[model samples]
Target: MGGSKTSLAFLVLLLIGLLSGTSSDAHSLSYNFTINPRPRPGQPWCEVQGEVDQKVFVSCDCDRAEIKYLSPLGEEVKSMNAWETQTGTLRDIGDLLKEHVSDVTPERHMVTDPLTLQARMTCRCEDDRHISGSWQFGLNGQMSLHFDSENGHWRVDHPGGRWMKEKWENDRAVTEFLKKVSMGDCPAWLQDFMVCWEKMLKTSDAHSLCYNFTIDPQPRPGEPWCVVQGQVDENVFLSYDCGGAKIQSTSPLGEEVKATHTWEIQTETLRDIGDFLKGQLSDVILEKHTARGPLTLQARMTCQCGENGHINGSWQFGLNGQMCLLFDSENGRWSVGHSGWSHMKEKWENDRAVTDFLQRVSMGDCRAWCKNFMVRWEEMLKSTASPTSGPPAVQPTATAIGFTIGIAVGVAAGFGIIILGWIIYKMR
Candidate 1:
């Protein structure tokens, strides 16, 4: 009777252990398993587990089965008789160990909770800062963990970002940003200028934190422009330069004729902000002087931004004040606003010199027209563009009329595709 009672008690305890999932056959154990690049600063928290095509790391609690991973990398998995690969469709780098462990078949052991949801654990072993594992491409689509040596650190690496997606789980639009000290992964002088330029838009420390890109001149140093760029493994550019119309030729008679454009428009964004400005070139001509002692130009422009965005009612105020020309992206067309002088109107109607100037200006430089434009408009800073010669004789020189004529050139260039500077002028 005593022997039978003892046997019955042992069986009941075994059943309890199995149901609780803590069953241990003398030497088996579980550990905390996590996957990696670890999330970015502001990204959503992602528990490292069940990642596809990622490097695997192994560890275990000190008291648990003395955790041992094949060192020197890719050796083999040593088998433990107590544990067998659980039959299932899921597999990861950990399962790849079955190849080395004796008697273990390709059957994979996927870490799951009682509810079957992937549950993470604390797998830490004394002496094992981290251990890497191996995996074959044949084992894709299912969970995979690999223990490998990269740069000397045992890390959980992934071919794609968390959970197998190519992008960040956190959908923040701020990836590329600018720095005034001109020190960072991106530089206005090299890569995307809009990113750096917009970085200034979000920051209020231009006097101390901005680069004055000097491909051309922009008022007192955009007092210092610089581009220090780096490539992000995933994101693309968000614009950072300008384009202008190039005079292809002069007519035999000296009239402004046959010109080629030297401008290119490019934008990169995965999310669409309703009123984003793609680009803008403004021509502010001071008409009848207002008695307010304040100067106001009959500011007209061919703003290239988004739909549902109003200009001036004035210049489009970058989306929510961000530094960019927002416009409707249908044809990526330019919006024309001519409010005065017929000559300027004529230019607004048809010219490429101005077109090139405006395009570049919106990207972040006003030097496409006259280097003097930005220098004269200190209210604005930061610049870039190649040096350009003044327009033909028909183009007015340094006076208000000349300025109007210059804008007229940009306008007339427009009727062509119609195309696209900010210049302040006082009527003579």
Candidate 2:
């Protein structure tokens, strides 16, 4: 009887440990809106999609101007103090944007065929206590202009953005409004949203990790450094400098991983990959560039381990910010993005050894690494502080607002597999 009671006490303590160890994950509040004066048969004139941490919570379209809650969490959002005001404001912004689009230019606002404007605004608060905000505007699905709200600067991306920048940059009202909204109002709204989403935003048991390596062909004199950044979910945990041969921990989770044997193996693996990639860059630059001032090569490997023990892995290669190749680890197939690089695809596909190695690393090795790190991740969370119990007394929400825009599709480059016999041949 006494032994059973002791066992029960142990179980109780374990449950308490689990609950106390709970830490909040990164959260984001964002909205995507599109303005199309002339809509297709099924399309809406003005459309809006709102998300909290990647989950679509609410959406509105021409069929219904009223916002519709798509998730249970979104339903709770109606109880927020400023919910009605905020929703109404969003509608007002949509109408204002439509008017603004009409006044731009004949090329943009032609009576017969008007160019659609895509806009997005986002406020993100990370577990590390970092906050980020963005507002982007695009035309005909191409990103044209971006606003840096903190500095109130408008950066022109495409030629179409030049006129918009010229019009808005000198306009103090426009700059201040963007600055006030993103730096002030967006964070305020996020704070309110966080209160209702505390339980929903808790760190999940499932684990995800990604490593992105960007290598420049002709890095400027002071910037010859090739680095690998590793992210566990949305937080950057570790970064390795290839030139300096140094590894720096960016978070508590990273510090813990640094002491393990796994870290040692990972460092060596990264170095080998970097060296292998460096050898191929010159040939690629020669082939792709007739006259190139600046160019970069990037490789990304990602893996996710679900609560159900299912694992998914992917490998992506890019040049100058354009996706060139994608590896479907599940099917062990290489997808070439451009026809110009079909030579690379044929070479890699024919080289059975190299193809198999990439599949093994992405599908097998990456999954193993993620599973091991997940244990460490859970342990680290136990020492972290819990999220604030409640949001502070609401600040006066600002009329300033901006959007977070997704990248526009571009010409995808092609990828060539690395020949790393000396480095990876031993893995077999």
Candidate 3:
């Protein structure tokens, strides 16, 4: 009995180790991965049609995710209270950060010094305590350290030491310093360096936001679409919604382009852009859709054209202000002259950063296109706002009777073959 108990305790310890190891797999608050939660067992996605139009909402809010901005070392943290939030993920970090910053009560406004806005950073540290360090700017730009020294180890009690260093500038210095000081071995020079680094962060007004969330994307297989939350600019949030947003097709293409979701973002209409495109290229047809919303979600269709409107390219459209297509267009022969939009027009002639998305459709593999057009359509409108002007298409699905007829035809063909063989043998 004692031996069994010992074995049980050992097994418990082993399980505890496993669980502790997996703790690193946690998301910033959310993560990105493919999911196919709709299909029935053993059934390929080909069996389902409506799955292509389905939308799956991704939760970017993580309970553990954090958004860190210019808590410049020496300078007071703009959102000091936010440094303690440990829940929420990428899904809602933008909103969370916004809320955190907005919630901080503002003091009397004063004409402040010129602070750099180089970057708005978001990071998920192994220990949230590591994200910040101790130091503050005293009156007249005086700097003071708020760390405690004990047993030859230096530790910051107020969570304000590490933030003083630039995230990447001379990262080697911090790395070398941290290699020694990371484990509570902070020295005087390291503390001063931290203060200078934090100053750089507080002064910069513009820069790329960095994310270092510990993440494990729990991707569901066969999940058609995925959503990702990120920012291209400091305050501008970007969303790539791939939930069942499908690419449309015209006659000759037969849905050659995979139906995919357009990246949803705050941007303009595509028809106005299409007009711009039409001004540049002759004979342009822009198919557009306006989803119901206050913003009037818009989509403008641009088909890939070969000789005589033979479509060789296709793309998925999103309610957001972006479009991407892989087309073998004769129109590409002309130099795209839009001073601001030439890069997009010239994109995908040969795939670089955006060709890895392969979506399976009834037609074939649809490569994901990432060219964004910032042009607005003539206007955002609703279907109910306008009367129906075109005849609806009528498609009749073939029934099981068609299969019966095929079977009957095959039986007749077999009988005829047998009879012909017998006749040939008898004649010989």
Winning candidate number (TM-score): 2
Task: Give the alpha-carbon lDDT of every model.
Answer: 0.21, 0.61, 0.23
Off by over 4 Å in 1: 1-222, 225-332, 335-428
Instruction: Give one digit per residue, the lDDT tens place, for model 2 in 151-187.
Output: 4567775466777777778878666655555555667
Q: Weakest 10 consecutive residues, lDDT, candidate 1?
A: 228-237
Model 2: weakest 10-residue lDDT segment is 406-415
| TM-score, predicted candidate 3 vs. hidden true structure | 0.17
**Of the candidates numbered 1 and 3, which has the greater TM-score value?**
3
lDDT of 1 by residue, 43-87 (tens): 212121111111111222222333333121111222322111211
Question: By TM-score, how accurate is candidate 1?
Answer: 0.15
Estimate, for each residue in 1-428, the C-alpha lDDT of model 3 and write its tens digit: 56555655565555455434322110011111111112235411110000000111111112224332211231332233322222222223223223322111122113332111100111111111121111111111111112211111232211222333223223454333222221222122222232333333231111122101111122225422223222211112232223323222221211221232332221122212222332322111222212221111112122221213232322222211111122222233212211223444455334432222211110121111222211111121111112233211211122123234545655655655565455445545
Q: How many pairs of residues in model 1 come into backbone collision? A: 71
| Model 3: residue 231 alpha-carbon error in angstroms | 26
